[model samples]
Target: MSGSVNMDMFGTPLQKLFSLMQLTLVIAGLMGLVLLLWLLFRALMPKKGQTKRGRKGK
Candidate 1:
């Protein structure tokens, strides 16, 4: 059989590879951003069991 290159899901082999790489990078970046935001929020917010000292009687 002659050498025949079959098209991938993204049309050609090169395109498919590039598309997959781009998708991977995008997902990784989003996950990193989410983790950073979560950490920032946790750092800024107070713990549930602790309350402000002067606000207890209010």
Candidate 2:
């Protein structure tokens, strides 16, 4: 006897929606991580021309 397999159950609109949601979450997480790293770098770095701000030319 030969058996036939059905692929109709997996090709529904719900599957597409779930895939889209997963992709959105992944992208959002990556952007949040990048922002956190940038903030840390800014806080740890120093300012430039700090001594020349208050003094004028003699």
Candidate 3:
């Protein structure tokens, strides 16, 4: 059971992979935060005018 595990990558590649993962997570989190802010802003603010694409009472 002691010699049953093996991994190929050791130092540099693993560090690079971890860095890449961190960067990707940061970017995704920022994108999600921006999307949430945009949605909240749209939901909380009053509409200024009738949308040209409105089809409700046409």
Best of the candidates, TM-score: 3
Question: lDDT value for candidate 3?
Answer: 0.66
In model 2, where is the ten-residue run with the lowest total lDDT?
1-10
Deviation from native of the Cα of residue 39 in model 3, angstroms: 0.3
Q: List TM-scores for all candidates, in order.
A: 0.59, 0.58, 0.59
Candidate 2 overall lDDT versus native: 0.63
Q: Report the lDDT tens digits of candidate 3 across residue range 1-58.
A: 3233213323468766876798899999999999999997677553635544444533
Which candidate gets the maximum lDDT versus the true structure? 1
| lDDT (C-alpha, whole model) for all candidates | 0.69, 0.63, 0.66
Q: Residue by residue across 1-58, what tens digits does model 2's lDDT show?
A: 1122123324666766776788899999999999999997566544533433334323
Mark the 10 consecutive residues where model 1 has the least summed lDDT.
1-10
TM-score of 3: 0.59
Residue-level lDDT tens digits of model 1 in 1-58: 2234234443677867887898999999999999999997667556745545435343
Instruction: Return the candidate ranking by TM-score, descending.
Output: 3, 1, 2
